[model samples]
Target: MKQLTIVGAGWAGLAAAVAATQAGWHVQLFEASNIAGGRARSLQQSFAGKPLDNGQHVLIGAYSNTLALMRTVGLKPDELLKRIPLDLRFADGQGLSLPNWPLPLNMLAGLSRAQGWNLKDKASLMQAAWGWHRARFECDLTWTVEQLCNASRLSPRVMTQLIEPLCLSALNTPLNHASAKVFLRVLHDALLGGLGSSDLLVPRVDLGELLPNVCVEWLRTRGADIHLGTRVSATQVSALQHAASADSAVLLACPPWEAARLAADIAPKWALSCAELTHKAIATVYLHCKDVGFNGLARPMMALHSHAQAPAQFVFDKGALSEQHGLLAAVVSACTTERDDVTELVHEQACKQLGLVNVEVVQTVVEKRATLACIPMLDRPEPFVAQGLWACGDFICGPYPSTLEGAVRSGQQVVTQISQVTHR
Candidate 1:
C-alpha cells in the first residue's frame, strides 16, 4: 500500500482520509489550525458546561452522501442530529410547515396550510411550482433568481415571505446576482429528491462533535498520521516536495485562497482562476436572553423579517436545539457590514422581530469569505490539476452550492479517481 497525504482536516479532507485509509492506504493529514474543524468548528465556550457552535448550520436529508460518510465512520446521525419535518415558522407560526408525507405532496400540503398567504397567493405559488417542475429546474446560465421569479409571475407575497429568504440562506448571494440554475438545483434536491430530503437536520451537538472531532478519533484508530498547526508552505513547487513521492499522492483540500497559493507554482493557471473567485461574508450574532418566551414561535429555528437596521434573515434558538440556554444565533447571510455594525444591527433586529427586550451580547463571528459569491455563470477550476497532485474542496467545480455535502462529495470523488489510477 502507498502513502496518501491530505492537507487540511476539514470535512472534505477528513472524508478523503477515511476513504483512502479504508482502501488500504497509509494516511497523513495536516491542518494549519490547531483545531480540527475548519469553518464549521465550535468556538470553545463552556456555557452550561457544554459546547457551542460558531454559527448555526442546517443540513437536509438530501445530503445523503454526507450522511453515508458519517455512518461509515461509526457515527450515528440520529443521535448527533435532530431531524425535523420541513418547517419555516416566523412571528408566531406565520410561515411554511410541511407535515409528515412524501415530497411534492408534503410541499403541496405545506402550501395549502401556509400562513399569512391568501387563496390567490397560494394558487399563484402552486402554479409557479408546477412550472418549475415541468421545466425540470433548467434555466439559462446567465439568468438570475430574481429574473426567474419575475418570469414565472410568482406573487410578491411568496417572494418576500419565502423565496427571497430561502435564496439568501442557500446561495448566500443577493437575488439579483444569484444563479437561477443553482437555485433550482437546490430546490429540486431538497423539495423533491426523496422522502426526507426537505427535512432539516439540526446538529444536537457542536459542529466538530458531529463530524471533524469524531473523524479524528476514527482516523487515529485506523493508523493515520495527524498533524495540527502545521502550515505547508507553497511559495514554490519545491516546498511541497517533502510530502510528494513517486509512491505517494498529495491531496490539496484547503480552501480556495490557500489552495491557490500552494498551487501557484505547481499549477499556475488553476491557481490564478481560484484566486480570482469573488467571495461573500457571513456573520453569526449571539444574543443571550434569559426567560424570553417563545411566544408561539417555538420552532427550533425561524425566519426573520429583515431590514437595514435588522440584517439577520434567520434566527436559531440554540437553547431549544441543544443544551445551551437563552442563546440565540442570528445569522446575517451574504453580509458586507462591518463586524461591529452587524452585531449592533442584529441586536436591534432581534428586539424588533422577536420582541426580546433584554439580552446580553455574547459574541459575534464574521467569516469574510464564507463562500464563493454563487452568481450567474460563475467559473470554477478543475479538481484534477496535475498527476499525483489533485485538489478537493467545496470551492471546486460542482453542481451543488458550497456546503458540507459538496465538500464531502468532492473528497469522495478525488478518492475514487485516485483509486482507479493507483489500481490501474
Candidate 2:
C-alpha cells in the first residue's frame, strides 16, 4: 500500500490528507496547534456569549474546490454557510449590491442601481469591466492593482468604494503593492465563472466546525492517523523516511516558515525561496451591543469607510449570520497597526459609521502573518522540493492568491503529483 505522511493539519494539510486517503494511500496527518484550522480556527474566548474566530473569512460561490472538499467530508456547504448576493454596500447603502439574479443581468442590474454613484462613475466602471473582459482578465506581470486601475481608467469613487476594498480583502495587500495579475484572475473567476459565482458565502458556524473538525472525523473513520498539538521534528521525519518502503513519501503541509525549516538541509534553495516571501497581517475586532435584538446594519455584512484612523474595511454582523446576537466583527486586512489601537479604532468606527454607540469590544484577534504578501510577479516555491519530499500551501506556486481555495487546490495538486509519480 502507498503511504503518505503529511505535516501540519491546516486547511492545506487537511485537504491533502483527505485526497490521499480517498486515493487509497495510507495517510498520517500532524498539526502543531491543538485545533486544526490554523489561522482560521475558532478561539476559546467568548464574545457576547458566543465563540470567536481567529479571523473573519468569506468564501465565494466560485470556490469550487473548497466546496467539493466540504462535501467529500459529508458536510453540505449550503447548510454550513449562508449564501447572499454580492453586496458591497456601506452603512449608508452607498455602493454596489447585486441582486440574486443570474450573471450578466445581476451585474448590470447592480451597476445600474448602485447607490450614491453618479452616471459617470457607473459608466467608468462599466468601461473598465469591459476592458478587462476583452483582455480575458490578463494583465502585465509587473503591474500592480493601482496600475491596472489607472490603465483601465477607473474613477476615484469606484477605486475607493469598490476596487480598493475588493483588492484588499482578496489579496490582503495594499492596492499599490498587490499583484494585478492575481487580482484580475480573482475578478474573472468571480464575475465570469458561472451564474452564482459571485455570491458571498458567510459561515453560519465557527471556522473549525465549518470544515477542519469534520474533515478530521471523516479521516479518522477511514483509518487515517491524525496528531494534533504536536510538531514533527526533522530527526523523527528522517527516521520515518529510513524505515518506510519505496511507496512511502513525506509531504510538508505546514506554513512556509516551518516548511523552510524542515526542508532547509534537503533543499536549501527551496527554503531560501520560502524565506524570502513576505507576509501581511489581518485583524478582526469583535464587538457586542447592549441590546441583542437591535440590529445596527441593513445587511449581515457592511463595507466600512476606511481611512487612516478607521482601519477596518468590512464588518460582519455575527448576530444575523451565525445566531450570535449582538455580536459584530470588523475586519482589517493588511493591518499594520497595533492591537490596542485597532480595537479602539474599530469600536469607534462601528459606533460612528454603523450608529452602534453602545457596542463594546469583546475580543481583538490579530494574525501577524495571515497571508503571503502577494506582490507583482512574486516567485513562489514549487511543490516538489526533493525526490520524495513535497510541500503544499496557499503560498505554493499557483494562479490564485493566498486563499482557502488556493490552499485546498495546492493540497490536492500535491496528491495528484504523487499519484502521477507512483503510476510512472
Mind giving the per-residue lDDT tens digits that candidate 2 earns over 1-424?
8999999998999999999999999998999899898777888987556568999999998999999999999999999999988999998989999987876788789998899999889999989998999999998999999999999999999999999999999999999999999999999999987878999999989998999999999999999989999988977766665555559889999889998888887788998999988999999998888855686557889999999799999999898888888889899999999999989999999899987657878889999999999999899999998877889999999999999999999999999998898778
Q: Please estimate how well model 2 matches the true structure, expressed as its whole-model Cα lDDT.
A: 0.91
| Tens-digit lDDT string for candidate 1 (278-365) | 9999999988886456432367788888767789988888777776788888999899899999999899888778877877778898
lDDT of 1: 0.84
Q: Highest TM-score: which candidate?
A: 2
Per-candidate Cα lDDT values, in order, are 0.84, 0.91
Candidate 2 lDDT for residue 107? 74
Worst 10 residues of 1 by lDDT: 235-244
Displacement of residue 282 (Cα, Å) in model 2 is 0.1
In angstroms, give how far residue 132 of model 2 lies from its true place. 0.6
- The segments of candidate 2 whose C-alpha lies over 4 angstroms from its true place after superposition are 241-245, 291-293
RMSD per prediction, one decimal? 1.8, 1.3
**CA lDDT, candidate 1, residue 139:** 82
